[model samples]
Target: MYTEKVIDHFLNPRNVGIIPDADGIGQYGDPSCGDFLRVYIKVKDGRLVDVKFLIQGCPAAIATSSIMTELAIGKTIDEALKITDDDILEAIGVLPEEKTHCSNLGAGALHLAIEDYLENRKDN
Candidate 1:
């Protein structure tokens, strides 16, 4: 069963959309588990000004994406990179043991987005 926090997040997920001109973007999925997550970020003045996500999967994935966006907003790029699975699980209050992959989905997506932004910036 999903926890109250998970259910609440799923019912009223936050930052549940896309940023068309996002400074960074990341997408990740597990074909075996059928969970996919994508994160968008807008950075300003060396800080993460905003974040958005699109998730396709289970409750945990939804909750993770929602909470991850909330946590990443306003953080410096380096600071945001420090966000981990434990941080997400704590923010959501609880996660089903089997659904721990949701935390990874969140972290990996954010990390990939940041990496993409950095790489593209270097190319310019």
Candidate 2:
């Protein structure tokens, strides 16, 4: 079972693509479920000016990734890093207990993206 918000996001998943010149990129996967997510981000003046994702997963994964972009876009790097699994779940409504772990996919990827940016920033 899925929530209405979840269904809406899943059916029309947002930010589904890649940024060839992404300032940062991150990947996260749940091996147990064979779900994988790759996130791309563009930063401007220390803010996430753009965020996108490509995922191989189910409805929950799609919806959460969709909402994660909505939440992270325009946020400063620190704020984007704070976008957590719970933050995503609350935004998209409830998922089945078994699928709740899917909520982690987005925020995890997003955090990694930010981390990647920070790490690369040191080199620039």
Candidate 3:
């Protein structure tokens, strides 16, 4: 039901916690799928110096969230925004068709986090 990469990430998820002083935070969930993903970002000089997640979901959701951080960290905000669901699927290598929606949780959250960061920055 899971690929080697998927199993590995699920078993030992990366960026698996929160950033207490995060510069930006975003969450995404599909109630029907019972997956909820929250992402946090720390930016410096317009680069994503750090990224983290707190996830309540299946193995696929956890794996996607974990992999998303690995792909996004160190990227500039513009670059991060360019990360798409296909990018995530390719990074993970493959995913079950039924679980594909899990792939979006990470990208969606990252996008929202960046948006939140940008919006708040504009306010001040």
Identify the runs in model 2 with alpha carbons over 4 angstroms from their true place: 30-33
Residue by residue across 1-115, what tens digits does model 3's lDDT show?
Answer: 8999999999999988889999899989965668999999999999999999998899999998899999999999999999999999999978889999889999999999999
Q: Write the per-residue lDDT of candidate 1 for residues 33-114, one digit (tens) a residue.
A: 6898989999899888889998888888898889999999999989999999889988998777898878889989999999
Give model 1's TM-score versus the native structure: 0.94
C-alpha RMSD for every candidate: 1.3, 1.3, 1.3
C-alpha lDDT (0 to 100) for residue 79 of candidate 2: 92
**Per-prediction TM-score to the true structure, in the order listed:** 0.94, 0.95, 0.95
Clashes of each: 0, 0, 0
Residues 45-103, model 2: lDDT tens digits: 99999999999998899999999999999999999989999999899888899999998
